[model samples]
Target chain A: MSASDVTRAIRRMAHEILERNFGCVDVVIVGLQTGGVGLAERLVDDINEIEGTEVPLGSLDATMHRDDFDLRPITSEAATTIPVDPTGKIIVLVDDVLYTGRTVRAALDAIHSYGRPKAIQLAVMVDRGHRELPIRPDFVGKNLPTRRAEMVDVNNDGVDLGEIS
Target chain B: MKALRHLLSMDDLDRDDIEYLLDLTERYVEVSERKIPRIPALRGKTVALVFFEDSTRTRVSFATAAGRLSADTLGFDVGRSSVNKGESLRDTIETISAMGIHCIVLRHFGAGAPWRVREWTDASIVNGGDGRNQHPTQSLADLFTARQHLGDLDGRRIAIVGDIKNSRVARSNAIGFSKMGAEVIFVAPRTLLPASLEGWPVKVTHNLDEVIESIDVCYLLRMQLERQNDAAVPTLREFHHEFGLTTARADRLRDDALIMHPGPMNRDVEIAGVVADRPNAVITEQVSNGVAVRMAVLFVLIGSRLDLVEEQSAVA
Candidate 1:
């Protein structure tokens, strides 16, 4: 996927969030660390343009709460920023790829560590259908049928594509 | 899912269990000196950390040990979660267990809280710490340190001083020390020692100077200001005068005798600064051994699929 394709998909996912939520007042878009935060910021910008109002944006480092942290050392250097009150405000959790849903699980746990959000909805760039959990993305940009061994890399800044090793 | 196998509390660990963990720790301490110090035992396994209290040392050490063995780690702090919103501890643990977490490392401020968590979760539990009742890991590390110094635990005189009744360190150390064939003497004021000592296999004394002179190993426990339940708590100055291991007290011990503390020391309250930093002091060694001991504990409890590592060791 090209950078243009990535932007278009995020814009689409942002619109779906607005349409489903019936507007998004006091709504905050929080991206999971590294690549997800970049995409989340872009989505927040796109959503602001569509609604003709500023939408808050945030980023999170799920390093401390990562399941694979003990297996794989934390590499992300991104900082967390939650601008809106998580309590009673709608939180749109953004991530690059939804695989076995473990990263999402860690991200949710990390977000809760920061503050309590009244409601949290997950949005992802790629819905690689091998979810180990019962979770499904609330706003999915594209559903790519992926094998168990394949890894998806969504460059929220440059190219967005699922690469099979 | 065996409830007893879960190490959510000190009560879960009896004499044999402690011995097994100690034996495993000895093996791992040796294995850590190899060229590549890691095992593949916990591969594809996950250990969740539900830390209600913040701990830098324990968290990092456990994470590093787990990573060396290729196990996944899930850690969460409680402040931002439903835990802060009045969610029951059992409910939180049950939710994580449902996610297929294989093991849990929990630390709480209330005694027996981990037991409550065990009631709701099937994951094998390692009690990082819970209230003032116990910090088994610290004691395990302490035992490892003692074994390293004395070469053996048999016929060793281990003296534990200060905040005897209030300190989980003292409690766990007394049990572990005595179990390992060391004669442990609890040195503290009558007010400090628990009123009832029916089952403890240790001698009680109020004379720090006399006990300090006799022991081969002097383990000083910090006098916890946090645990002082009353405003009439003894002043640090008066406490030190009575029980602190001053330089004068250190001189009373044999030349080869070892001194140790669990860290975050109070200087003169339970131990003197120089004594804690003395050449005989193994406090730093204790901290370093903490990682190795925890590595062994995590490996054994979690079963990190480490047949390859042991096979490699055999060939070496």
Candidate 2:
């Protein structure tokens, strides 16, 4: 996948979010740290281009709030930027890849702690087939079937591809 | 093999883990007091100190401690690191981890920053100091100093003086002392005490004189000037006048009682010079013990079997 693919995904995701959640004029696109944050910003830009209005961009680090807190180590404190009011506003959670659905769950828990959002929608670049929880991405760029043993890394910067064995 | 997995927060460690670390420090303390003080525990290990925030004492002490344990130390000032160029903290950890670093001592300016680093790697990441969050080693050093002077922290009165609201050291110490069965009295101006203190299982006091003499150990905390952005305290002079440990106040304490500071002491601001230098003072001792405590922490988190380190290294 080239950089153009990632760009196209963002553009498509932004349109879907605006069309489905039509009544929600105030929308916040919150990225989950790393790759998700960059994607969220790009999506927000795309959303602005499509709707002819600005959307807020926020970033969150779900390390501490993760259920697998003990399974792995803690991460460096990422700057959590919630630019717009979450109360009664639509929160669209963005990530590079949606695999186990744990990151989204953690992000949702973290967001509630800051403020109450009217609703939340998840958008991901790649939706790998296996999901450990009852979660489905509302806007998915591509559905790449992946095995549990393999790892999915999103190169939103240079190329967009899932690395698997 | 590796030195430490990480020191996220003190709460991450259980009671036995804390004791194991203390016991390790005890052995190192004996070594330091001996004619020759050197250990090969970290002989071939490399400790990388990545501090994104300004920390004079924590950075220096950790480096000195790592050196004493025979570990090669590399200190990275964030002002010069790739972080200044907008490289995320996680990427920086990954970059250092790839360098075959045995341990990473990180002092980040954000609260829970170390925990954040912990998520990124399996290497032992020590929290040099996090922003108004938890400074586990400082508390460990404080506890070590208190125990060294007072024999045991159990049932002893420990008055944590000054800047409770913004001092992670004080917060960690309060919890640590309490866990050790010591009565922790948080002595500070009403403005400086954390609102969370009410939830803490300890007595809080605004008047220093009320709890000062009753305590076996007076733990002086340096005023966190960084909290100046929040105006955490109204005035430094007023804080000193009301809560600072003066020479006159020192006269009232038991002779055997200890005066401890986690240093880079605020000197005239937090503690009087005479008391700070007094025979009962364990300020310097804390610095020395910091290494031992850190060594123990590194030892446990990395692996108890140092022999296996060679095998692990060969495999890597």
DockQ, candidate 2, comes to 0.01
- The lDDT for every candidate, in the order shown, is 0.77, 0.76
- Give the residue spans of candidate 1 off by over 4 A: A1-165, B1-4, B8-19, B34-36, B231-233, B304-316
Instruction: List each candidate's DockQ score.
Output: 0.01, 0.01
Cα lDDT tens digits, model 1, B1-316, are 1113565544456666666667666655644553445545567889888888767878877887787666899987897789888888888888889999988999888877877787787788888888777787888899888888788788899888888777777877777777778899988888788778889888888888777767899888878777778632368888888888888889888888999888778997888887787899999888888888887677656563334444546778
Runs in model 2 deviating more than 4 A are A1-165, B1-4, B34-36, B230-234, B306-316
* Model 2 chain A weakest 10-residue run by lDDT: A68-77
Q: Would you estimate the TM-scores of all the predictions?
A: 0.61, 0.61
lDDT of 2 at B67: 66
Instruction: Write down the worst ten-residue block by lDDT for model 1 chain B.
Output: B1-10
Model 1, A1-165: lDDT tens digits are 777877889889988999988998858899988768878888988998999988888886654455654443222124556675577788898988888888788777656644577789999888879888778899987788878777777773544444454
Identify the CAPRI category of the predicted complex in candidate 1: incorrect
Q: What's model 1's lDDT at B86?
A: 88
**What digit string (tens of lDDT, one per residue) describes model 2 on residues A1-165?**
567877887787777898899833878889998779888888888888777787888887665346653334331335566776587888999988898888888777667755688989999888887788999999998788877766767775533344453
